[model samples]
Target: MSHEIELKLALPHRALPALRRHPLVSAAQKLGNAVTLDNTYFDTPALQLKARKVALRIRRQGRRQLQTVKCAAVSSGGLSQRPEWEQDYTGAFDFGAIDQPEAAQLLARHHDALVPVFTTRFRRETRVYSPREDLRILMMIDTGEVSLHTPDGVERSAPICELELELEAGQPLDLIELAETLASDLPLMPADLSKAERGYRLFLGTPSTAVRAEPSAIDATQNAVDAFRTLAFSCVRQWQANAAGALEHTDPDSIAADFIHQLRVSQRRLRALLKLFAPALPATFVADWSVRLRENANRFGDARDLDVFHAELFAPVAPEGLADEASFSALASTVRRAREEARAHACHNLDMATQGRLLLGLTADLHRLTIDSLIQAADLRTFARLRLDRLRKRTRRLAAAAETLEPTRLHALRIGFKQLRYAVEFFAPLFPARAVRRYLEAVVVVQDTLGFLQDVDAAQQRLAAWVAADARLAPAAAFVLGWHAARYARLRRRALRESTPLLSGRKPW
Candidate 1:
């Protein structure tokens, strides 16, 4: 991912499942024998800035197989903005105590919580015929001092804790039995005071923030939002990587087409993100920018979709005609003509000197725009209005250009159609997403009708050339050409009627 990544492990109070104690439930139970450790964590300057965490932790659990979970925290000291929020991400690592001494010591040094029970693992494993304790592993993430006390009797309930164990059906805690037992026998009870959590430390209650008389839900929505954005950024970055590799070689068609696909997906993320987070951001900011980016993106999308499909899909069907060969020369000829038309159109649409500049501008904008800024702008509504206007204007411009012949007008009209559809999509969400979905279907109808016709026209020309390259299929080539001409006319008529600009000014949303 191009964006920075931060991981934290947390068990929020709201996320806990409801608790019910059965007749077998023990007021005080024990984990027969298990592994235990005592540990603490700290924060450094760089780790604090990047992870928004000042402290780190590693906690160990289990006996025979020896499993350890690492946890980290961004203390309020490291967290500067939105004190109510904290970020967390988690993953698990296994330590092999059976064979490796290094793994044991490493666990001893880094692991903290449940250290007191480390010695119990041997006991738990030693029992030959007993059922395994349904132990659970969990972490509690508390932003404020959350009260676990019951309102009726003032008995404290466990708060801000996460427990993990693959439970059998209807059995929630083999581990809870152990926890309750340890609390009863030892001086430790569920910690009411809040402390920092880390890759290695255990904390409970209110974290660094002051405790509240009444607790509020942990607002990790911002963190969730950022994680999603980071993921989106990664998708776009893949295109950047592909586009870079394409630059290294000389196959313009393969390279340029892949780059365009990446561009299209990148634009899609922009579109979806704008819609998804519309509630959180300013009205039209994501929409307006979406329109602008779509303008450039559509030019590539139209040309490349056709070009790439033909290259990847049809090449297998007519490999011999690809160049000069003994292969099905007629089929190869047809494909070449189609490829040339689409490629020339995309390349010629922009001035030679400025091709990279226009493409880069769109990608750069996506990279630079911040999630916070997108929300603060004209907002989704106002932005959508502006985007629609821009798209409508562009569509009209292309409609005018379509007056010209074979390739030039076709090229211009392609650009117009892309921008117009995108505008409609931007507004589509304002109505029913289902209705917007229907509009996209109409778009496909137009493309299929027109696209089929264009395929025939170009195919006829290419097939004729293939016959010339290798005369063996001369008779078949002639038959195909005749079929293409008639089909081409049919498709053209369908396209012209379907894509009339009558709805261009309508309230698309």
Candidate 2:
């Protein structure tokens, strides 16, 4: 059995020419001949092997056939480590060379039922780079498609364009550094999805859905930097998972708006985590990444704003009469067109070259972060407590000043609440789950109320923009403006009432 350590990157097909001529790739030693790999993945009807997190595949290169079994892998920031056992694939199934007894047993039980599930045929160009003494890396550029044959004889395929950096020798950190340097000039994004995973997803016909933050288990004994890495990685995974969905669909009109929303939320969560750990982390690094994240997520802004207008402001209120209905219909039609335009703008920016680079840069930054003295000396519990108290104090002070606060100030309070909530969620395992839940519940009340107020303000702006853009939308926008304005006082009251618990709630930390 041999362990495989590699970093994967997803690139746009259009960027292939630039990548080929890039200094990094051009400087690397060309290793042997390029090979065309035809790989067939097998699994039982019930997908028992998939359930076990095992992959069985047979690859044909020229006249030689190789059978390989790969165990479950640990992935973070597009880097993966897994154990693989491979041997000559004769005609029949080969389990004798399988190193893991449990995997071997499981394969043998369902060996007869195993069938070809999917295939990936790609031409790979190989290059080797010696980053430094005693450290060598193999760079494989693969371009092709992953296809699955359904029982009904339908074929479904998704294009594949990727770069694999496999460590031939030396430390994994060295690999990360090399990747970061290469990506500094190239449009590259770290891809967390493995081809096998993508193939299985295609075979299963799984549709993408909105993903939320999962709980991060931080050991009390862990240092601050490691805990931050754990939280950062979790947030990165959520962001990338949603990003994959966004990239898979080409038609912006048909794409789920939640994909963009969830991606933004994930990016926001990472930003919040950075703020919470700013003192312990490199300040310059954190500041640079925050700006980059804002820039990247903001690319999807207009689409999201239009989506909110359609979903929240327009859909809820029905026209009272025919005149109102005509006006509303015109307004809706105009809004839909505007949404399509915005979606097009967003999609154009997110295609082949730009989509993955920001994400890859983010992943590379996280991988190369160095723990400062403060972080190394502090336990996660101590650091978390300090962070929570600071945010709580900031939140309360803002809530207290809410009476005379401007809309922007109120928005600031909402941001504070969001950060506090995310911090609580990130460090929930450090404290009791029940206590954390109570704290989160209180924070949610304040955050939701403020969020509604902010949304109303935004809706008003959207309505004004629509009315200004088209005279036909004037009456409909007026009706919406009147309807929404009347509720502002009520919304403010609710926000104030809900702000009580958050301002006065005992700190769980």
Candidate 3:
């Protein structure tokens, strides 16, 4: 499917309102007599997201281009969202547009008999763009009216402000080379901000330059358990979304790789949320599965990494035109052989039948957790209290469990901790939970220890590939020894910093 190139020039605020009313633009629709419906805005609060919008626009049938411009401006101050993606349709929509009313009457409603009114859509995104002074970017001036029409032909218009920029889809982003082929000549500047979230500009808020507060989380405890439950529901909803895409994945390798990554993240977050609500549930209830999933994720991650190295790094380095090029030609040949072996290793692990079975099993577990029956107890108030108590007790148990665990098994133990933490999260509304605040502090401590370990592990694997493939550059490979030493030193410091010992009892394993 080919994509359209769209350029939504963020109209200067001072110029937009007058531009809308200009004779060349407005007389086409006879706007003086049109019944205009005001603009409406939409967003998901739990996601801490705001939407920008475009007016409903259309062009006449015989009026040159069969397209209209649309807009959506957006901003955020919180941590980046986890790995979520909108649908992957990369198409664009826009053109020589007429006002909302006339376009529908002249082109859509009546032209159906002679012309085809195709809705070729592309996914729209609105993300905050920071300002850069070097670029002569357009500054926000003021808002123009955004009008809508009801099914009964009643129409309304509302004043809204926004900053908008549109571009042709799949265009190469060339800041230097070949920049002329795409949306070039555009400069950059600080987009101003507006507090009012409505109308046509609703998608691109009124522009201001004041720095915003880091988006602190909503105080779910103070708001009531029902509010915290909203987060729980959102998490479960995400799991279902993953499940819905089950069979549609034509590429098993990409799908498996994605699922494994999501599993790791879900486990980490679940642990964090469980810790928040741990004052309630039984510690034993979710501990085991956490270990299992984390181990599986690590296993899958290893396979995926090897897959990348095998595919990406196996090729011979582009000949650098060395005077003695043949001196290292054999080394490249050796690297290619290693790459084939690494690819075989990763592929053997990714046998779709086996991976699919694991995914199906994981999906079943998620369904069990998300089913309405498991959640339907009573009103939000009652549910909140019950969940709090269950999760609190469970958390203390997890904290104690973490105090034990052998070094080799720490990954597995963390998994157990995560599951209980997530279950607690599931029922967070029932308690006066200080989990989010407390855990935010605890995470740094845990990651400093555990995270350092994982980083060194990954780094070691990456550096080892250079040694295995480039024996001729043995000195350069040995040069990497300094980095290895640095990593080991960091690893030692990480080991020394954690207060918890790896073993509390006799080795059960």
Candidate 4:
């Protein structure tokens, strides 16, 4: 058994020429001529192996056949590490080489029921990248398709074009640095999906959904620095997943708005985590990444704002009379055009190369992060309690100021509530689950109310400009604002009222 450590990157087919022209690729030694590999993955009808997160495949290269068994991969930021066993396959199935007891037993029990589930055929161009004596990486460029043969005699397939960087003798950071170098000019995006994973998705016809923030796994037994690293890595995963989704679907008109929204959420969460864990992290790391993540997330802000304006604000407003009908129709047209333009502009700037570089750089830097001696020994639960207290106090101050109903002040208070909510969510795992859930439920309500208020304020600014540009839009804008006037006032009062108990009550942490 051998542990495989590799970084996978998805390359646009159009970028193949540029990748070939890259200096690093040109300088690397070609292992041999490109070869074709045909691989068949096997599983029982019940998919017992897949259920256990194991993969069994047989590969045919020329006249030679080899069987490989891979355990579940631990992946993040496009890098994966997994244990695999490989041996010559003369004819029948073999689980003898698999040293993992659970895997071996599972495979042996279902050996007779195993059947071909999916196949991948790709031409792989392998090169040896040896920049120094102690460093070596295998750069393999693959382009082909993964196919599934259904019982009904139907074949489903998806195209595959990727670059895999297998760390042969160097640190994982070296592989990422090399990828960053290549991505500087190529349309390379770090891909967390393996061919086997892709094949399974195709076989199962799984629809892509927006990735949300996962629950915090931080425990009190760990040190503060380790807990922060764990949380930070989860944020990176969310960011990378959404960025990949946004980049994959290039048509702005048909793109899922949730992708852009969730990408921003991930960035905001990371920024919040940086503040929450600042004491345990290096000052420079926190400061630099906070700025970078904020700038990147802001690129999609216009699109998200327009989406909310169109969906939540405009869509709910109905024409009450003939005059409203005509004016509202005109306003709707303008809003649609602006929304499309914003989406297009955001999509245009969602450059794969830029995003890939940012992700890889962050991942590498995160791996290199070191804990100060003083921070390395601090109790995680104690640190979490202190941070949560600070956030709660700050939010309480903001809530008090928000009572004046000043738009700017209210917006600031909303941001404060959001940060506080995120901090609580991050530290919730360290406290009693019931108390944390109760507190979080209240935080979300206030945050949601404040968020709606902020949206109304933003919409007013945009609508005012539109109204100024066209007198016809003035009545429509008035009607829209008037429609939400009562709710906005009520929510404002409710926000202040609901936040008092949350701020004054027994804390979760």
Highest TM-score among the candidates is held by which one? 4
- Flag the better candidate by TM-score, 2 or 4: 4
Model 1 TM-score on a 0 to 1 scale: 0.37
lDDT of 4 by residue, 140-259 (tens): 999999999899998899999999999989898898889888887888888898898888888888867789999998888878878888888898889888988887678989878999
TM-score against native, each model = 0.37, 0.92, 0.34, 0.97
Instruction: Evaluate residue 20 in candidate 2 and report its C-alpha lDDT on the 0 to 100 scale.
Output: 88
> Model 2: residues >4 Å from true position, as ranges?
96-102, 184-186, 322-326, 372-374, 404-406, 469-472, 485-487
In candidate 1, residue 218 scores what lDDT?
Answer: 19
Which structure is stronger by lDDT: 2 or 4?
4
> Distance (Å) between predicted and true CA of 114, model 3?
24
**lDDT values for all models:** 0.40, 0.83, 0.35, 0.89
Better of 2 and 3 by TM-score: 2
lDDT of 1 by residue, 1-509 (tens): 01111111122234323211222222224345433332223333223311432223333343222232222222110111111211222343233322334324444445343222101101111111124454323321123222222234443222233222222221222333333332232221122112332221222222122121111111223332343344344433443333332333334354355555655555565565555445554456566756765675676554665564455334424333333343445455556665666656555543211323323333334334356554444344555556566655765666555644355466455545554564454345445566667766777676565555555555555556666876775665554445445655666555555666434634445
Count of backbone clashes, every candidate in sequence: 49, 1, 47, 0
Q: Ten consecutive residues with minimal summed lDDT in candidate 2?
A: 351-360
**Which 10 residues in a row give candidate 4 its minimum summed lDDT?**
318-327
In candidate 3, residue 118 scores what lDDT? Answer: 17
Expressed as tens digits, the lDDT of each residue in 1-509 for candidate 2 is: 99999999887788899888999899989988888999999999999999999999999999999999999986765788999999999998989888789999999999999999999999999999885789899999999999998989999998889989999798787777777777767777778778998899889998767777777867898888788888888888888777777876779778778888888888899888889888878889889988888887898888888888778777777677634777888987887898999988877766534556666667667777887676677777877888888888888888877776467778888988898899889989999888889878878877877887788778777778778877788888888767667676777867767777766766677
lDDT order of candidates, top first: 4, 2, 1, 3
The positional error of residue 66 in candidate 2, measured at the CA in angstroms, is 1.5
Tens digits of lDDT, candidate 3, 1-509: 12222222223235445544444233322212322222222222221222223223233322233233333322211001111111211222322233444333333332223321111111122322112333221112223454444346655544433323222222212111111111122221112222222332323333212121122233333332334334433433333233222212334433444443453454455445544543333345346545654554454455445444334333322435532344345544544555455434444443333333333333233323422333334355454445544444444455455444344344444444344335434443344457443543443455445544444455456656765765564543333334345655655445433423321211111
* Candidate 2 lDDT (Cα, 0 to 1): 0.83
